[model samples]
Target: MELGVGWTLKPVGFEDEEDGQDAKKIVDNQFEKMDYHGTIMELGMFYRVLGRACQVNTYDLNGDFYFNKNEKVTGADSINPMTITDASLRKVMADRTGTEPYVQRVTGSVGNPGTVELEQDRVIYITNNPFAKYSTYGNSDLNNSVTDLRTLARFPHYRDALARLYSQMHRIVTIDSENSYNIIW
Candidate 1:
């Protein structure tokens, strides 16, 4: 995407410059530890191809749901978009909060499947189709080309068959040649 070469942290209005520098140092350290550049690049690839991407956050061994702006974040790992079954968004006006912001994924084989529900704070989710309000999953960038891709895939076989059909030679022999041979004999 090349939105920016690298990340920068600038002090907000009325914030101390030195404090901003310190915060930047801490963030840079975490970025290095988490391989943020590489992970983001990978996520971008998935987002382009599959129309959605996600990275699950890893926290310290203390406990689950330790998501804060401090040292709670240990690392981040990317998840395959295909394995993600569903994603729910937060409801602002619902009384019961219909569904929490979470992502459900399937793991293991079909014979022995496992479901994992990752809370919203633990995931960095990106989608190509963010305008769809009620949809759970993002639409693929390749969705429009699916039929064209299928035709492209079968083009080689069809072209080869047509070539073989047109390559055959049809020869016509006249009975006059046989009669001429007999007259010569």
Candidate 2:
């Protein structure tokens, strides 16, 4: 299944009505060229499975308005969460924080490594299950099921098949309310 994103550009007053419509057109055009829907789909999967996802913004106002617009959108580039080393967050409230500056991304191996600092305005950072509202990183959604997953992975072919078969079978038992001790299966 696919997810769709939508928004409206409300005019502040009657005088700015036309400006709102133009703004909406520009924003819509930008999203279409970038394949925003497809990008969002991938981002959602990554966020749920890996705990976080990111997409960097790029712009090209010099290009034509509508004609040959399909070539304009290459889709915002996504950064692998594994490579993200750290982020610079500014405290917005006692229990909340935001990323408005940048994040550190590492490249190459530990022995011969390189780092790229991406500005917050250019990079979008996403995280879930953070230890605190102010925490920067997020915990994976599968964290609680790790043990079950490991056990399933270790099961042999015959054992796994047997488990599946047993899962499909159910047993029902009946008990007499008056006697309480008598039971039927």
lDDT of each: 0.60, 0.59
Model 2 scores a TM of: 0.52
Q: Which candidate number maximizes lDDT?
A: 1
Q: How many clashing pairs does model 1 include?
A: 0
Model 1, residue 104: what's the lDDT?
A: 58
lDDT by residue for model 2 over 1-185, one digit each (tens)? 22223234454554577887887788777767666666677677677778877776665576432323355435475556667655343321222334444545564555666766665556676777546654456777777667656666786555666567646654555544446555444
The segments of candidate 2 whose C-alpha lies over 4 angstroms from its true place after superposition are 1-28, 60-75, 87-113, 156-185
The TM-score of candidate 1 is 0.53
Prediction-by-prediction clash tally: 0, 1
Give the winner by TM-score. Answer: 1
